[model samples]
Target: MSRSGGEKERKYESDESRIDSGIDSYKSISRDPYWSLQSSEEKDKSSCGTEERLDSAYASSSLTVDSLGDFIEKCSISEGENATDSENNNEEEVNLLTTVTEDGDTILHLAIIHEEQHFAHQLIELFPRELLDIQNNLYQTPLHLATYLNQHSIVKDLVANGVSLELQDQDGNTPLHVACERGFWDCANEMIHNASPNKLAHVLEAQNWRGLTCLHVATVHKQRRLMRLLMKKGVNLNTQEGTSGKTALHMAVELHDVYMVNLLLNSGTDVDAAMFNGCTALHLAVGRQDAAVANRLCQAGADKMIRNMEDETALDLADGNDDILALFPFDDIQIMGRTVINF
Candidate 1:
């Protein structure tokens, strides 16, 4: 089944043209893949033909792993050849790199997903920065997937190559969110320590759809180590969650976490920072009947007089708890060298 060089060239050109034309047509029609797919599913139910064509183009462009390796080998061979053939090879490389699966996963994505570490490393070297950020159907960039899968080297390489660290997955989680949530220290460190100084703040503080920042996630997950790392990286400790406006201290207090409360206090967290309902950590501690955490907060100078939306102060919420009520004094008080009350 051997063919002449001319015949092989013609076949390559034909396949390339079909793939390229299909990709261009898809781009022209669907600017946002997720939205377009949804519209086709719900309102434009009759557009099945259009959807099929799009799917066909995506599927047609997918190369088997072996095919990809062989094509990449051919591209490497053409690198130092004459100008015309080199130009053709470069065009083919671009087309191949941009080809996505029906799930919108590029070859680079598949390589990482399949844990082809050696091949993934090779492809990372070959891909341009823009190509490194191609998101799959789940809106997971290769960096997100790599972090979620705990691939430290891939995370390092992707960050070193300057991929956007702020690209959120379908769940609105940045790679940092995934790293912090999963307690992956090395992967999280690569992102925090290597990100551009100006941009690192945004990455650290970026919230998910649920309004939980990386620090909030770490606190909720009880990741003190990651929380400390984030704090050292200058994350805003007092940033509130989007839903209830509860800071990390607020969460720690509600969890009856005395150690966490002390950690936040020592870290200079705003002890009286309020939630959306004007409830402070002190209020939550007192209401939850957590005598230990409430005492810890009081020792750390938590304001007992701050009222909640229900017009209840921590003292008002301390219904019949002598241990909690004992921490408060009717006169002005000083704890941890901070004045917590004013007459």
Candidate 2:
């Protein structure tokens, strides 16, 4: 063979030998528990299998406690081995805390979802503080999950540990918003009590993606207790939503929720508050043909002559409803400085 050909053959053999050596090294590392623990990809793959086993284990009623115990033990052993090495231990615990199911739920997330308070507490204690706020694929922290699930104990634990109360989920909903929306009064109250004064104010006023504050959410959901709680916390009753530019009073008027309207009005909500389109709460109440609500608005000092973008007053919108028109006598319904046109 030519010298060049022999050189090429030697190089080819050398490349093959290097490839084989690399494969053998990978195999050895894969077999080593410490090395495997350090491999995120391997841990992820194992997490998938572990979740499957968990699901199967949970399916059989008899295996529930035993399976959880076994799983917890396995996780504990992995965590215990690295305890002496604080940095590595933290990293490992973070990885474990954030190890997700197919839906990107950590074990902590699952524990909350399943209402396993003990397991959730254990995970909370084991995970690092920063990891407590680690978001799942949906950007939901453990606090969000616990609040959504109405897990009071878990919520309390998370709050006591200083998990972020104002962290927004994917939809820009804070845990407080979730609690109000879900009608979890206890959870909502817990959040309110546990939050720092500054954070409490921020959370109460914070708008979700739809631009609804906790007050708006309470009003929309007709959660009277939640609304009262927010009010006690000094939530702005007239805070307008981004989408409709309507305050909680506007929503209450539109929904014909007389009690909520009164609640808002008595709490100092702007009775004459207008939307982006310049439609006031009175205009909406009249449009909805809610005579009681209209009466309440008028009593609250809602302006009768306020014109919308269309230059229409509440009376103009109420022209078709005799009951509403009757609320305002002919003299009171007339626009100032204009000839009275009887409806």
Global lDDT of each candidate: 0.76, 0.73
Candidate 1 lDDT by residue in tens digits, 177-200 = 998888998999999999998889
Give TM-scores for every candidate, taking all chains together and pairing residue i with residue i.
Answer: 0.73, 0.73
Pick the TM-score winner: 2
In model 1, pairs of residues that clash are none
Q: lDDT score, residue 144, model 2?
A: 87
Global CA lDDT computed for model 2: 0.73
Model 1 regions more than 4 Å off: 1-95, 330-343
The lowest-lDDT stretch of 10 consecutive residues in candidate 2 is: 53-62
Model 1 lDDT, full chain set: 0.76
TM-score between model 1 and native: 0.73
